[model samples]
Target: MTAEPPLLALPLHAAAPTGAPAARSFTTQLPGDPRALYLSRVWVRRIVTVLCWRGDVLRAVEAVTRLVDNGVRHGIPSSVPPPEQQLTLSIATDDTGSLIIDVADLNPAFPDFEAAVSGERGCGLWQVASLGARVTRFLPHEGRGKTVRAVLAPGPVGL
Candidate 1:
């Protein structure tokens, strides 16, 4: 059998807003790399800390970990011809005191959010959703991939 080409590398970039209550954004390519995953977690924690997340740091870390794991496990190609792929995570906070975390990957296969909940094969999204966060998926306008996003609100008042 013919071997598939190596996965194309995706560029990673990060930025923080330049105003009050700024937000941080991160982009990374997912190529089944362990280092990338670890780095992702580190950066996520850093962002959470910078944002002064006053409650459940562990839970936030867990959520981010699951998101990266899911991207590596299901977003990559493992069959006949593995295709080049990448994943990105972006975090930001709005003036209204809401934290938005977006995890995106290059998976053409539309993930069944519901099936993922019902079946044991997928539960990362479920955990993310269970946290009272909003999840959404969309196709990139200029690429052959899709992105899944999750938005979370900060803890209750007087946390």
Candidate 2:
């Protein structure tokens, strides 16, 4: 039986008052489980919706899950998943006010964007890029994994 993993919710900081320089954001750390992916997707969608980034919800969530899937699959062993590789999902705005969706995992070997886009096997991340999610940057953890960040700008909602 799989033990339920813990969920960590950060302080709500998604929206800032007009003229404020620092934009708010929301963060949640989840386990490397399918259920965790679902929860994270829902939670992020809500934040995007509330922030009026309606156009970004679907694409942002899509990229979030794809990143989570890659993270869990490669970072955690299927037979014995580790909490150390817990998925971290965060939604915030950059200094420029663009919506940012960040997902991190304990995998040092990040996704190969070139292969994902050109090879048939690596279509997941390709799809993310195809949706116009700008891969902002990749931040390495102290000595373990890395966080892949993608940005989505507010626009018309997608059908």
Best by TM-score: 2
State TM-scores per candidate: 0.68, 0.71
Top-lDDT candidate index: 2
- Over 4 Å off, model 2: 1-22, 77-81, 117-121, 141-143, 156-159
Question: What overall lDDT goes with each candidate model?
Answer: 0.58, 0.62
Q: What is the lDDT of residue 18 in candidate 2?
A: 23
Where is model 1 more than 4 Å wrong at Cα? 1-24, 29-31, 53-55, 78-84, 117-121, 156-159
Query: With candidate 1 superimposed using the best TM-score fit, by how many Å does residue 60's alpha carbon deviate from the native?
Result: 1.9
lDDT of 2 by residue, 55-142 (tens): 6567778877777776667655444455454777777764565677667666656456556644455776667667776653454524
Q: Write candidate 1's Cα lDDT for 1-159 as tens digits.
A: 322222322222222222234344444444454445676666777767776765466666666677778777776666424444556676666565566665666676855666664444567887776766566666666655556665566774232
Q: How far off is residue 35 in model 2, in Å?
A: 1.6
